[model samples]
Each structure stands twice: as structure tokens, then as C-alpha cells.
Target: MPKLHALELVPDEAGQELVRRDWQALRDAGLPSQLDHRSPTNAPHVTVVSAPELPEAAVDVARTRLGSLLPVRARASGVLLLGGDRVTIARALDLDDDVVRRALAVRVQVPDRQHVGWLPHVTLARRVDRSSVQLALDVLGHRDEVLTLTELRRWDPDLGAVTWLAGH
Candidate 1:
């Protein structure tokens, strides 16, 4: 099996912490949540692109491609439920922002279905049951929050490392 490498945009501390709080809320409510993933590499982020395998030079290429688009101000509009069989609860990021869309457009094309288009979300939970949708929503109320995207990162699952690419 090939290692999965994801190119993503990460928000500042405030934004990350807010997502963390949401995860904690869901977990405390005994619901499926990202808090279950205790890996050091796991955190709140918007995936720009993902592939089973990417060249070693991908970092540099991404940096050059998306460097100037940093510090993008985006909105975490509200809660989102994605997927067909198993639902995923997430905080929806605003794609209407041209800067956010342009930055995400630097994604490397991959053949995976999930990578076909970007919805720009910070996942809160996965495999949430239909019965628990309302409960999850209640736990995490409407979030009309702004997030300042400050960095681009490469999350290499094989190496379990998050390498900083651009921004402070």
C-alpha cells in the first residue's frame, strides 16, 4: 500500500483551538469525533489535495505555488455532513472567497474521487450515525467564525510528520 500525503492549509492557533473545542464537545457527548485521533500529526486543517504518493519535491513545488496566498481570511460558516453511507461532521469553510479558492487551486491532481473537488472543511468527526446528526449539531452550534489561514503543510502519514511549507 502506498503512503498517503496530504497538502493542506492550516489556520492560526485561535482557529485550531476552536476546532479542538468542537471535537472535545462531540467526544464529551459520546459521539464520533476527531478527538479519537490522538496522533501528533492530527489537527484541524483544510485539505487542499491528497494522494497516495507524491514526489519528494512536492513540498518545494507547493511552496512556490501557494506561498503568496497565505494569511487568507476565510469563514467557517456552519456545520456540514458529508459522505453517503458513513457521514462525516465538519466545519464548512467558505469557498466563495477568491483568495481561499485560488490558494486551494494549487492542488496536485489525483485520481481519487474525494480529491475531485474541494469543499474546504475542517473535519470534526467521521462515521457519525444518522440518529446522532441532530445531537452533533446541538453539541456544536452554528459557527459563523472567521479563520485566518496562515500556513501550508504536508502531512505524510507514512512518516507521521507535518512539514511546514509556507507562511509563519
Candidate 2:
């Protein structure tokens, strides 16, 4: 799979700590977690749009349109296991319809962020081992949280960098 650029919704300080605590818990349990990603740019975020290539124009448009809808109330629904063999454990999010609508308006061809069937989530662990799935689940139960997504940022994995688009 090719690397992708993404527009992500960043949580406030308190919300971030909530996620970090989860990461730490998984780490303490000797399970795969976002903490293992090892990049300074690696942080908790709900991806709104992603594509193999995102142009500067597209980024600017997202900054203007999506940025205007700052401070969205996002509910961390629960823990979800995505993918087949190497599962991705994530915290599902329940966002407003308008947020989903504007995300599709970005016109990105990424299926994961499509309006028809988009499962918004903030990933906790990537490619967790099958043997650790049950353990990870046990470690991180169905914990729910109400988080305020306060910032919009663009993630360029190629550069290992993030460009803050909006919010305090």
C-alpha cells in the first residue's frame, strides 16, 4: 500500500491525554500500540480525508471549508478491530452528519472516507498481532469518551510532518 496524505481532526489537550493514556495502557500490557509508531508527528487524530496524493490546492480548500467547522463534538463510541489478519485496533467516533458531508465535499477518492460508508475512528494500534488481539481488547475495553475536536491538520507521511490548518 502506498503512503497517503490526510486531513485529520485533532483533539484538544484533555482529549489527547485520554488517547495517550490508552496508548500507555496498551504499551504497559506489552501489546502493539500507537506508541510504537515512533514518529514525532504520530498523534491521535480522526482522519476526515486521505488520498495517495493531495495537492496544495486541495489542502487550502480543506483548510477553508473544514476548518470553519472547528470544535466539533466527537464521541468516542468504542474500541473496534479493523482489517483482516494484522488487525487495526481503533476507537470509533460518532461525528455529526455535516462533518461527514463536508468531508466528502473535499472530493478525495479515498473510499475509507467516503460518505456512503465511512467509519470514522482514531486508531490506537496499527497491525496488532493476532495473538495479541484478545489481550489488547482485554487491556482496552469498551471505553467511551466525549471529545472536542479542536484542530484541523494535514499529515504528510512522506515528509513525516504535519501542517496545522486551523483551530486553537
Candidate 3:
């Protein structure tokens, strides 16, 4: 089977620390009860593009395109409701030239859809209900924060593994 792949904007160590602290505060306040079942090490991150499957050469292409691209500042803008099960914290990315060009080159075809726009967002919690999400928003108070895009990741579905291909 073809693997699922995504181009994501990962946080740096310092950024991750900030996110961890925020998560802890939320957890302590009982805003993220759903997180209790998951590991705390699963920090926050934003995805640029996701594809159901990629060509075998996609990784190589991604690596080449990403290697020289410098890291950029991504500022969180607001909170968004992704689905009933998930809530997204959105960020505005200062994408590098190569990053933008490379992302535009990749095409994703979702069934029954003509095209889906690429929306950049970092997830706060999964399997969350509306009440829980409302609690989280109330706790977070403000919808904005600044984070850095530090890495790109590749995920293999068949192997059920994720690999970090680039880091700044």
C-alpha cells in the first residue's frame, strides 16, 4: 500500500518547551482531560500539507527541497474548530521560497473533492468533545502565540512509523 505523507512545520526545542508548559497548565486546570490517556511528550505541531499517498521518489524530492530551506517564524493567529473530534490552533507561516515552491509542486487528490486547500494548523487535542474544547479555549484565553517552524516529517503507513527528515 502507498504510504501516507505530510509536510509539517515542527517546533524547536524552546518552542516545544513553551507548548509543553501550556499543555501542563491546561491539564492542571482540567481543560484537557482527553490528554490524560496520551503521553506528555507528544508536543504540538502544525502541518503544511498532507497526502494520502506519495510516489516512491517523493521523499527524495522532499529532502532535496527541504535541506537548504531556512527555518521561518510561524505565529499562531486563532483557534479553529476542525471537526467534532478535534480542535486546531492555527498559525500563519513565514514560508521560505523553496518551501512554498515545493509545497505547490505536490498535488493531493482527495476522493469526491475537486481540490482541498492547504490549511496550516497545529492540533491541541484529539478525540475532544465540544464541551472540552470550549473549556480549553476558556483556559487558553488568548488565541495567538508565536512559534518557529523547525522541521519536516515523513510518515509511513504500512510500517506505521514516522521519520524526521529535516531539522533546523
* Best candidate (score: TM-score): 2
For every model shown, what is its TM-score relative to the native structure?
0.88, 0.89, 0.71
Per-residue CA lDDT of candidate 3, range 1-168, in tens? 334455555788877765666566667876653345363324466654556665645556666665446365666666656665555433244444666666554433223211376555566555556667667777666656767767877655555667787884
Q: What TM-score does prediction 2 earn?
A: 0.89
Sorting all predicted structures by lDDT, with the top scorer first, yields: 2, 1, 3
- Name the candidate that leads on lDDT: 2
RMSD of 1: 2.2
Q: Candidate 1: which pairs clash?
A: none
Q: Return the lDDT, model 1, position 54.
A: 58
After superposition, the stretches of candidate 2 with alpha carbons farther than 4 Å from their true spots are 107-117
Stronger candidate by lDDT (1 vs 2): 2
lDDT of 1 by residue, 1-168 (tens): 566788888989998988889999999999999989988778789887778865555556567766666777778998889887779999988854665555444554344423566678999999998889999999999959888888988888887888888885
**Once superposed on the true structure, which residue ranges of model 3 sit more than 4 Å away at CA?**
1-4, 33-41, 85-101, 107-115
TM-score result, candidate 1: 0.88
